[model samples]
Structures are given as structure tokens and as C-alpha cells.
Target: MAVKKPTLFAAPLANNGSKWSIGTETNVMKGLSQFHDPLINWSVESYSIDSLGESIALVVRNPSEDMAVTPRVDIYLVSADNSVKPKLLTGSFNAISDSPVFIKDGKKSVAREWDCSPESIVWSANGQTIFAVATDQGNNIIFAINATTGNCTRMTDAGSAMGLGTLGENQLLFQYTEQNKCVDIHILDIETKEMRRLTDVNSDKLRNVYIGQAEYFWFKGALGDQVHGWIIKPLQFNTEKKYPLALVVHGGPQASIQNIFTSTMWNSNIFANTGFVTVQINFHGSTGYGKNFTDSIKHQWGRYPYEDLMIELDHVLDNCSYVDKARMGWSRWVRVTAALVCHAGIFSTPGAWYGTNELWLPEHDFGGTPYDPKARSNHEEFNPERFANEFATPTLFIHGGSDYRVGVEQSLAPFTLLRRKNIPTKFVYFPDEDHHISSDVDQIKWLTEVLLWISEHTNTTLPYNLNQ
Candidate 1:
């Protein structure tokens, strides 16, 4: 690495075979045999290893940072010694940084990225022929890539609308999704164009479908509704007792809250099994619901999505009698009021004022008053004021340090305002996390807090690992 200005870290690659090296755009190359120094003026934002461990470095000529810029890639070779080596190709590689694939031979190149990506290249055993499989996304034709010609031909287009898998340099398998009413084992095979159905469920059935999840429910929402939700209950379910429930709102007014495993809500399981109900809602405007529903969020982002969540809340609290709403109580409401009133605390940029509230459209205030009569123009008024004077229920607000959605202010605003109002509100900030705390330690620590909340509020024993 050259003595360049401070750099923001990106994706990483490990140097295993020592056949590759790194070169900075500053013309400073690493891993040279000391035989010859090649000076080619080019810059690379980052570099990574391919599945084959070939020496492919990504070089982006000039990238724009002023706005959302598309990512591009170029591949290079390196020698065992700590310096850039012989060139393979010097032309454009069509691989979009989204799934970049640049092919190089001697001094030329052929690049490829996908358009409606369903068909993809699966590595063949010899690394000579890759699997080319396509489906509704187009086609999947497995064959060989002339590492020399940059040309490709299909081996098994089978024409069965097959799902492609690479068993080796020349082998592949295809599968598909199935339909059941509600089962645990989720198997999706787009390459094979198959669908599975979810059938029955019970406590013991938990082990079968949910992989230890005691209870799960699927809610199909209404009202511009393409919305869906998943409720993951504790592995230990007690039919006789009620439990505290949480409504985790996935942001993205345009992004769906998936039932699959993800870092954002990885800590959800801890609370669920500890006598607390963990619920995630994918509201109306969430993506994966189709284009019409997604586009609805545009221009009118906050209002419609908020309505969906409110409906979701109603769905949870209404049908589920065992839910402990008192646990949600007043303190949480107060914090929410604070967020709306003061726009929560800021992050990443500018003053201590927090981010969300600062971006609150300036047109909100009417009559030059902090408590504006116009705030509830279209929204019904349960209470005209933002933070009711004396509220109950201790509330905790968490935010990823780099979360732009809802902004750090969204969390902070509620906490700051609620605390100032003499409400019991707690705020915890994840320093290394953005939107989702990707680190395992940070996730466990977060799980601990929720566990404590559950143990204190609900009549359930805490997990042993969290006892520490």
C-alpha cells in the first residue's frame, strides 16, 4: 500500500498463493520480483480475489463520489515478489461491481455484467467451463469460457428451465422453491423454477420448520397492502401465560423485512426465546411487493408507510391477547413523540441536534409556535401535543451509527425529548454499526439488553449465556 491519504476500507481479499500482488493508483506496486518496474498510470478503488484465486485486481479509472455512482471493475495480474506484474487485458470488463467479472488473456479484455440476472456462471471443476444457467431472469447455459478467447458456449441448456449448480469444474445441480402453508425448512431454487409450499406447524414442529423456533405466524396485510410480517416466538412457548411483544419496524419504507437470517435483526432470536414476542413488519411501501407498491413511497414517503406500521401494530395487539401491551406502555410513546417534536439526535454530520429532526421539512410549523396546530393536518389527533406530560413504561432506543434511514436523529430525537419530559427513556448507540450491527459482539451485547428488558418485565427465566 502506498503512503496515500487516509482511506476508507472496502471489500478485502487474502493473498494465499502469493501469485498476486497489490498496486496503488499512485503507481506504487507491491509484490514485484525486482526484475522489472512497470509504470502504468491507473487507479483502483479496491481489489479482490476470484473463486479460483487468480491475480485479478479491480481498477476503476475515475469514480464520482458526489452522488450515487455505479461501480466498475478491471482485472490485473501480480507476481510472487510484492509488485505488479505482466498485464492480461487492457479493455473494459462488463462485470458490474455488483457482480463484476473481468476476463483477461495477454493484452486484451472482454467484460460482462448481467441485465436481468437469473442465469449465471457456475465454476466448472477445471475452471475451464463455467455453468451458464438462466431462468425467468433469462437463461442458464453451462459451458466453458475460453480463458484464451473470452468466448463462451453452452454445454447443458437442457431447455427444462433448469436451476444451475456447479458440482465441480464440469458438474452442476438445479433445484426450486416449494409451497407449504408454513414450514421451517426454506428451500429456494430459482434455477430449477420450482416452488415449495408451507404446511402445518406446532411446538415440536418448531424443530422441523423453524429450526428451533417455537412459534411463527405470517400476516398478510391490507390497504394498498402488499405488506407481510413474520412473528418469531421463543423456542419455549407457554400456552398458559402471556408475553411481552415488540414491533420491530424495518426501515426502507421500500425494503421488505425478510424471514430469512440477516444481521440487522440477528439479535431478535435472543429476546424471542426469553419470554418476549419479537415481531418484524414489512409495511405497504416495502420492496419485493412489486413495483406499484414500491413506487407509492416516492414523494409521500413517511405518511403512507407510517400508516402501514400503525395497522401492523393493531394487527399484533388486537389478535394476540397474550401480548403484554403494558410493557410498551407510556415511555415508548413519549420517546416517539420526542422524535416527531425534536427530530431525534443527529449522527455522521453537523451539530449535536441529531439528524432526523433537522431534516424535518421546514413547512411544519404554523402560527410560529413550537406546538403547531397544523402538525396534525391530515393525521387524527389522539393528543394535540407531541410529548404528553407524564408517561410510563421505560423505553430503549437503538440506532446503527451509520444508519441514514430514519437517521440517527430518529432514535436520538425520541430519547432526548422523552428524557427531557421526565420520561424514563434509554438510548444505546452502536458505534461500528450502520443500520445493522454487522459485528457479532455488538449484536450479542444488544441481545443482552433486550434479554434484561424481557426478564424484568415478563415472568420468564433469562437465558444462561445472557446471565453473564
Candidate 2:
């Protein structure tokens, strides 16, 4: 007998396949609203189907009833035979906090978070057990969630597991990335709970090159909250030599720095190779720790998270003998802290700054909703414009004109003000791009501008034509 493929049911705007045969503007807008993740990869909220075609599971994100700016993801199951309507599977209280399906270089990055989720749901050969990725207390792991009951069982202990899929009858195949290491494939046996490494791609290429060393540390943060973080030492670092510290802050006020392969945009390997000891602080309001930790910076925003960063910085500079306190510099992409750094004068020796799609407008800050009265007040404090009179750091602002999430004006306004104040500032705008620079050409341009600016300010010379 031939197997029937599962039919998909989603609002017209769902990133992938939708149940609807047609589309409309209103449906698109409704679907767009469900993209709750800061790095919104337009994809289906969730997809799952039983082997016997008895049920289809869907994870949909809808506007939260309590919070106007937040969207909550919930799972629902419907009878495949069409004999029954959809019934909610998971409760509203527990959110499937996996980072969405991450596709990098045409290969799936096996990590899941809200909205953009798992590449595919893993089902046992008998379809009795369903496995999915979830973020539990600041760690990403695979969990055995009941297919029908919507219950969950933790499966893997490896802090991070990506691209999880079924192997053989009782095993799983996934791409694994550990702290300060390269990405590799691994296999897990469900019955005996045994895990075996599959491949080591890093060893072949890195035989002669030194890779950074990484370790985890915790500290007391905002409101005496326990904050977890990671510190990555420069390649071939010496204990007696002090190196410039690079403070890299992650976006998502809701996301945390994971102990996965450090390749992506904030390339830790490149930074380590460039002779900089990198530090990533989960700070306040970072995910994978706990709901309270992630939510700690909800309204606190700039103040608490910055404090957490400062405390971490202080600890590193004090305890770590290799961290050069006089040469400390910081960098962040997308949303968190660019404005805060400018307005608050946080970093002692701020270096060449690279920020894209900066959020500086009161109307657009903090979800752009009237739900929170403090959003405007918070924006007013950290607003890049507020620091124009005293903007001292040499800054490079880049933005995409088509960015709907954060308007180009956010970068343009500050760049103009800084230029007027006679501060060293540069603005690079791409009219065709959105919030993210998707095209390779645009990305290279952005990186080139960043490297040239940093090199100019740091008094280093890179063998690139700066005229480009």
C-alpha cells in the first residue's frame, strides 16, 4: 500500500505549505504576526504527522491574550481522517521554546526556537514516540514528547543538539556543536541512552591551526539573579600575555549565547584568530536558563541587562589575568545595546562600532505597542538621538531601507546627528534589503565596511581595497 502524505493546515501566510489553497492580504498579515522570533525565518510554525495517519500536529503562534507584543506558540492535533476537528495538544502555559528551523548554507542548523522550529519531527518506527528539540533552562536538547498526550520526556543530555532525525529503528542522527568546537554529526541510541560521535570535520582542517578554548561561568546579576555566560580565549592564548577583550552581546534579549559551533555571523573563530579573547554574557532576559531569567529584562531592558554585562565584565577583568582592561571593546548585532552603549557611555574604551538596523525611535522601540507605558520612557533613556550631543565613539551605522522590523531611520537619524556633532560616523544603507542582508554581495559589503572601519580605528592595516 502506498502511504498518503500528511496534509498541511496553516494560515495563508505560513512560511511553507499552508492548508489554504488561496491567499489574501489579511491572511498574510495574520501569518506575519506569528513570527515572534527576533530572527524570523519565514517558515511553518510546526509540523508533525503520525505514521498511521491518525493525527496531524501543528505548532501555531498566535497573538497572546495577555501581552500585545508577544505571540504564544501552541500545538494542536487534528484527525487525519477528517472525522474530527482540531484539538489543542499542549497547554498555553508551556511554550515550545526551540529556535526555529535554522537553514545555513543550504544545510539545516539543528536548533529550534519559537515560530521557526525543527526541520522535521522525529517519529519512532512504530510512531508511538515523537521526538522534538526544546530549550530547557538555557540548554537545547531533544525531548520525547507524547504524540497524542502532549507530554514531554527529556532525551539527550548533550547541552546542544541540532538537526535531529530518526536513524535505524531506535537511534537518532543529529548535527552536534559543543563549546568552542566545530560542528559534527552524532548518533544517539534511545533505548540504552548511549551516544556516539559520528564525524570530526574540524580535525581535518584545524590540524595546524589553534582553536579557541571555551568555558562556562556564572554570576549574580540583576535582582540577585544567577546569570550564566561563556568565555572564549583567543587561539594559542598565553597565560602571561594580556589580550584585548571583545564583549559580544547577543540579540533577542530573549536569547542566550549557546555552547554550539561558533561559526555563524558573530564568528568566534575569526575573532579568536584575530587575537581577541571573546566573552559572551547571557545577561538578564536570555533564554535556555529559565522563564524567569529570560523574562527578567522584559521591562527592565537596558538597565538590568547592562548591569549584568558590567558585572560579568568586572569579574572577567578582575579574575582573568589575560584580559587587558585598558583595551576592552564591545560589539553587538541587530537589537540589543547599541543605543544603550551610545547613550549611557557604558564601555570604558569603546572601539569601532558596527550596528545594523538600530532601533532608536520611541514609536518603534519595545514592540511598538501602546501596551507598555514604560517602553517610551525606556527608549528615551537609551535613544541614540539622546546621545548625539555627547556621542564620542567612532561609529559605523548600517541599515536596510526595506527593514520593516526596525526602520532605516533608526540608523540614519543617529548617523546624521553624529556627523553634525563632528563625531566620526559612517552610514551604509541598502535600499533593496530587509532587516537582514540576505544576498552574499550585501553581506560582503557589510562585513567589508565593518572590517575597514575597525581597522582604521584600531590602527591596524588589512590587505583590502578600502575604496570598495
Q: Which candidate tops TM-score?
A: 2
lDDT per residue for candidate 2 within 160-222, as digits (tens), equals 788888888989998877665677888989888788888987797878776666677888877
User: How much lDDT does each candidate structure score?
Assistant: 0.45, 0.59
lDDT of 1 at 408: 74
Report lDDT (Cα) of residue 438, candidate 2.
Answer: 74
Candidate 1, which segments miss by more than 4 Å at Cα? 1-62, 68-97, 101-165, 168-222, 262-267, 325-393, 399-411, 430-435, 454-467
* Root-mean-square deviation (CA) per prediction: 11.1, 10.4
Output the lDDT of residue 123, model 1: 49
State how far residue 266 of model 2 sits from its true place (Å).
1.5
TM-scores for all candidates?
0.52, 0.69
Clashes of 2: 14
